[model samples]
Target chain A: MARIVVEVMPKPEILDPQGKAVAGALPRLGFTEFAAVRQGKRFELEVEGEANEEVLDQARKAASEVLSNPVIEDVVSVHWARES
Target chain B: MARIVVEVMPKPEILDPQGKAVAGALPRLGFTEFAAVRQGKRFELEVEGEANEEVLDQARKAASEVLSNPVIEDVVSVHWARES
Candidate 1:
């Protein structure tokens, strides 16, 4: 089976409280170098055959329409997981 | 500023209900090509200066110790965002 990866991130203009929380905790945990953090979603979709152009297209369509909320998140990428 | 991307995924033996829910919904939404789905997390950590070796090392440490629960998740990757 081929695995397709879809990544979704909060829009730049949107507030990400989860990311902010993580950023705040990092220093306390002794990881002091990072300036900021943004949390996003990653999805792996398994298909029966190759992750061909057609499957990638379908994955992209699914990413935008079903996996992410257009009002707050952006579908940043959709590609074969192995390539990543 | 430079960004480091960290990816976390559920262990292969771990049950991912969220991913299963999304997989179930996909067929109902008319995108029937996918056979299964697994959900994970992506983190973007911003740092000042270059994303050099030292910064990447810190990101890798943070990815495992703070960003993911070692009991259930794995730090799949830690790398410069631009390269991804």
Candidate 2:
């Protein structure tokens, strides 16, 4: 099967409260030396087809239109690979 | 600086309601042919250190202990790279 992965991250200018919470807790959890922390979304699309160009384009369109809000989020990468 | 990315996904046995919702909407949004979809978390840790083995281990530990819940979530990949 082909696995398509899409990464959706908040815009650099946007305030991520959840990420902030995690960043605030890291030091307490004994993890430090972080310049910053940003929490985002990881989407795994298990496709029943091959990882062809057309399929990848369709996945990208889906990610842009449905998976993320362009105003607040940025689609970092779309990876298409055969996983088993 | 090194960018350490930790991908936290719901266990395979777990039901991902949010991913299901998105999958259900994709077809309506004119994107289809997806066999399955699982939504997860993408954590971007902007570290002030180099991408050495020790630092990578520390990042992995932080991801397992603080960033994700081991009972319901699994760390799919831990990526450490330098990005300009």
lDDT by residue (A1-84, candidate 2, tens digit) is 778999999999999999899889988878886767999999999886666888888889888988899999999888874363
iRMS for model 2?
Answer: 1.1
TM-score of each: 0.95, 0.94
TM-scores for chain B, in order? 0.93, 0.91
Give the clashing pairs for model 1: none
What residue pairs are clashing in model 2? Answer: none
Per-residue lDDT of candidate 2, residues B64-84 (tens digit): 998899999999888874474
Docking quality (DockQ) for each candidate: 0.86, 0.84
Residues forming the 10-long window of minimal summed lDDT in candidate 2 chain A = A75-84
